[model samples]
Target chain A: MKRRSNSDGKSVKAGRRGTAARKRRPLPTAARKRRHLRTAVRRRTASVGRRERRDQRLARELDDITEQQRATSAVLRLIGGSSGDLQPVFASILASAVRLCDAHTGVINRWDGEALQLIATHNMPPAYVELRKRSPYRPDQHSASGRMLATRAPIHIADLAADKTYLGGNPPTVAAVELAGVRTALAVPMWTEGKLVGSFTVGRLEVRPFTDKQMEIVQDFAAQAVIAVENTRLLTELRQRTDELRRSVGALQRERSNRLMNLEAMAAAISHEVRQPLASIAANCSAALRFLAHDPPNIEEVRAGLNRTVNDSHRASQVFDNIRALFGKADQGRQAVDLNGLARGVLDGLRGEIEDRGIIVELASAPDLPPIIGHRGQLQEVLINLVRNAIEAMDLMTDGRRTLKVRTERSAADKVSVTIEDSGPGIDPSQIKGIFEPFVTTKARGMGLGLALCRMIVERHAGQLSASPAQPRGSIFRVVLPAGRNAATDATG
Target chain B: MNGQPEPQPIVFVIDDDSALREALSSLFRSVGLQAKAFASTSEFLQMNLPEAPTCLVLDVRLPGLSGLDFQSELAKANIDIPIVFMTGHGDIPMTVRAMKAGAVEFLPKPFRDQDMLDAVQAGLDRDRSRRKNASDAAKLKATYDTLTAREQEVMRLVTAGLMNKQIAGKLGVSEITVKVHRGNAMRKMGAKSLAELVRMADALGVRRTMS
Candidate 1:
């Protein structure tokens, strides 16, 4: 500073001298021009020196920024390559942070809502690492990490030995000063979603506190650590959800296959039913042909065979018509039906027979039973058939007490049911499965189409018909119909 | 082809369907064979079966018992009869099982007339041969029953390929006595030669009693 001022003083003196010379002697224009040239050269040299100094400072700042960027990119690469494994990522982050901040060693401690768990360490003393290994201990308030937590911000201590905690014999501070030989310490907290998760701490062996730029770099590393932790947690959650979805899809596929199998069985049954009459037709045709080929050509026998063939053909076609009716669209004449009323009407029609058979008819109807949407006539046919079957079943008892139970109730929140129970000889357990099949009848005079047609009509109305052995000695038949659309209620209820 | 008269070969049709049963009966009648139709196995079982060649054309899916079960029931009752199985939908396992149980033919429904006739003919032919063998054995048994105890023993040993001397040692009698007994046994069994007597003993299963 004194040399620059002296130079200024010299220039001022020279200026005054030139003025005095100019006043003293008006003859020296060349000497004055030479003095002007000398002063211009000196000013040019001083400006060049200032420019060089500025350039050098700018280059140093650029180098620092480039190094910090390279370190950050390297840590990011580590996090990406680790693929949810945070151990190597934490280690890489601590190493890069310590190096970029110009510190000697570093430690990354995960705060698990309770205590400091030292997760990763880079170049730390063996004694300090051993001390950290045996613990879920909270750092004393004097330590760098403890202060970082308490303040919820970064802490920079230029000289740990001179801190009041060091004078007060804080164990971690004393340990940092004595065991780790750490003088200057910098600790930055890692935050994720507004919660402090961990701390990134670095210390130098010399009494040089980190620069603001270095503190910023350390904070960046802490943020990167938070991202890696968050990424791992999200990835794990994604995998678990994916597994659950796979299980649900598998269950749905199994259910679909079971339904397909049931459809196949139903088709097989239909084919069997159709084939019976077709076979009879073929046999009758063969018989007629054989009769025509007889030596005497039996004309009467041929006529009989031809007539049977016609009958069988008509029977086969009837089977097809029945199948069509079973699966056909009968939704045109649908209306709201009261099952209890339907049952009562059917019983009224059979009141004389019931009394003759000495059958005690019990009607138990729930007043709140919901109405169902169906073809009223078809549903009444079903009820009548079921009641007649129950009466016939009871009539065969001959000596036992005959009782008929007709019940109606809300089977479910969106369903209504009608049950017919008969006290008679129960169905043989083995023959129960085919009772609803066409041409399979337990009644001696039944054409066997009654129950099958009844079942089809019930199914077309979005209802289910099932049979089970009733209590003691009888059979129970139930028809469950879906309530109309407006009858929906909470399923949980 | 025997010189004696041939009784009519009857084909019994047992099926739950009345139309098919009647059609089958008509078909059999067209060929000049007696045909009887029954709606169930129990109905068929109640009839008096004549002493003639008879074949049963049974539906595989019967109301009371399956045709296969009927086959086993007939076997258990010692009523050996040829069964021609007819089914609306016969799977491979059912066909194989029926065939293994001595079914004459397992004809699926809607079979041609020629096939049904051929199956019934095969069944009748089998039953005819079986009946011929059974009657022949019964006749041989009647003839053999006329022999004395010593002659019967000699006949058994003779059918076992024993020489007269070996027969004498087995019976503890002289060789001359053995020859006498063999000659009388053959005479009673109506055997014209030793080979004929052995055949008669074989028919009566007398060789099996050669203890």
Candidate 2:
């Protein structure tokens, strides 16, 4: 201050504040110097006051910024500690907003599609907490929080009792806040990108309006709320994805087990079906050798054995064909197969076995027996199983004659029927019911799948095969098939 | 080839395989031997087996019982029939098992005709020797049956190399009675000498000391 006073003294001597003790004769430069000195002194003093005041204002602004930073960091630290579990993160965010704004209540809701679901509440009434636990909140913009979410902006209702939004909007939003005794609140909308996620609201029981500073603190923690919502949403989706993966894995394991079991069943069927034809071929071979070596050559018997060999060889291939069909791996040939011709073929194939067992086979064919449309190999298997079963049945009858009667006829209803009647020890009445089940075998060396496979073949061709007690002490197996369109046309032709 | 009328050697063919049985029968008959065919062990057992030189050509596998098992079954029934086993799928263990059970031949099919004939011939030769021993035993039994109890005792003693005085002492009779009994026993047994009498007694399985 003294330096300014001195500089002003020197400038006035030269100009406006002129001293008469040293006045030159009419020197106008001193007056101008006096004017410049006054202007310079005024300007210097004014700038000093302005600079000191500005420094004081800057210090005050720094205090405000540091407090805001500390509050944000406090919320951020809480969010960082509980990213694994978002409930605590939400609780920390709510607590920071309520404490920072000095409010009595705080709530955090997560937006799921169109609804806000209350996940965390601080200082909540028992009634409001029970309501939130039981149901989700579908906001309709009646209360301060609802308006904030609708506008995707911060809403401050200094006094809810006088606010038009609380009075005119949805009743439940206002009713819920009134019941919880919230008289003042500041709600800020939280969002990720441009989409509104949810609202963070701090309420007070007093009718005091929230200060702009408190609203600023509330807005600060809103970011933490948005991040928490995103983290919790991602975590829930991950859990749901893992649950779906586990279910699919379980289904795959069950399907694998089922496939293996089916393979096991097919293998057993193949073994059981293949053994018969092989045994027949072996027998025919031996018989052929014997017949050829007979004295003077028994050419007739040799020819019979040779025919049996051909039949058995065909039967062996048919067994493999039937097994392949069972697995659905190969498409079997479907053709019009004559019941009479097929039965005669099976009988011829099993001629050696029948004769060896001393079973008298009587074959009768009607003049106009219609053919059935079906797979020839599968139908052959059906007839072969029945014929072999009849042969085996008659082999057990020692007291009476062993007779096997295989007959084919066309019924009046355009259906073809084949009946194999055996005069042997009749089937036990109890065994008749479950005789066609797989593994239901009577012979010691059998797997009991023959009749089951036979029934499957017949049924697949849309035919009915059944067993009944025959007159004069025996069992009879009958297979009736519908004469298909092609076969019926052929019959007319 | 013995200078005695023998029933023709028969080859019994027992196999479940009708062709193989027929083939074997034809082969045997072609070689001038009587052949009888049976389908199984039970069928073969039902017939009264021939007492002449008999050979059985059996299949190793059958519906009722296996050929090796049937071999033991024949032994259990006290029937001595030389068996020649034929198989379609014979392994070393089965061959070993068959041969160990006293099978005369183990021929696996499809055997050469000459090999089969040779096996049948060998089986027939074995059965012939067995028949010769059995017939000689029967003759010795017949000859031994004709002797009186005292003469039979004297013959046992004589074939045992007992002196006439010792035979008399053992028989509790006079030396002249012992001499008379020994002469009758020797004549009935058709023994030309003492060694011949010992041989006859051995054939009859009489109680004689070790040779």
Q: Highest TM-score: give the candidate number.
A: 1
Computed on C-alphas against the true complex, the DockQ of each candidate is 0.32, 0.05
lDDT tens per residue, model 1, B61-106: 6753567878998999999889998876646788899999999999
Question: How would you encode candidate 1's per-residue C-alpha lDDT over A1-493 as one tens digit per residue?
Answer: 1112111233465477468546533446788677668757865885686568557556766776787788788878887777678988888888888877778988888889878788888887888777777646576666656778878899888898898867776665676679889898888888877888888888999988776667887888889988888888788899899999999999999768645643554464465566666667776777777778778777898888888888888877776675555445555556777888888998998899799878999999999777777777778867877887787677446587899999999888888899999998877899898877644533221122346667766765667899999989989999988887642221112
Per-residue lDDT, model 2, residue B77, is: 84
TM-score of 2: 0.41
Q: Is the docking of candidate 1 incorrect, acceptable, medium or high quality?
A: acceptable
In terms of lDDT, model 1 sits at: 0.77
Stretches off by above 4 angstroms in model 1 are: A1-270, A292-297, A330-493, B1-7, B41-50, B62-79, B90-93, B203-211
lDDT of 2 by residue, A1-493 (tens): 1112112223444464246425545536788688669758976885786577456555655654576677678667766665468777778778767875668999877777777778788998878877776666676656555667777889877777677766774453565557788888777888998988877888999877776666777777888788767777777788889999999999999768645644544454665445444544554555557657768777776676677668767866976664566536322456788888999999998899888878888999987766687778767767877877777666445578889999988764768889999997778899798776543533212222456666666665667789999887888999988787744444344
Clash tally, candidates in order: 0, 5
lDDT of 1 at B53: 93
10 residues in a row with least lDDT, candidate 1 chain A: A1-10
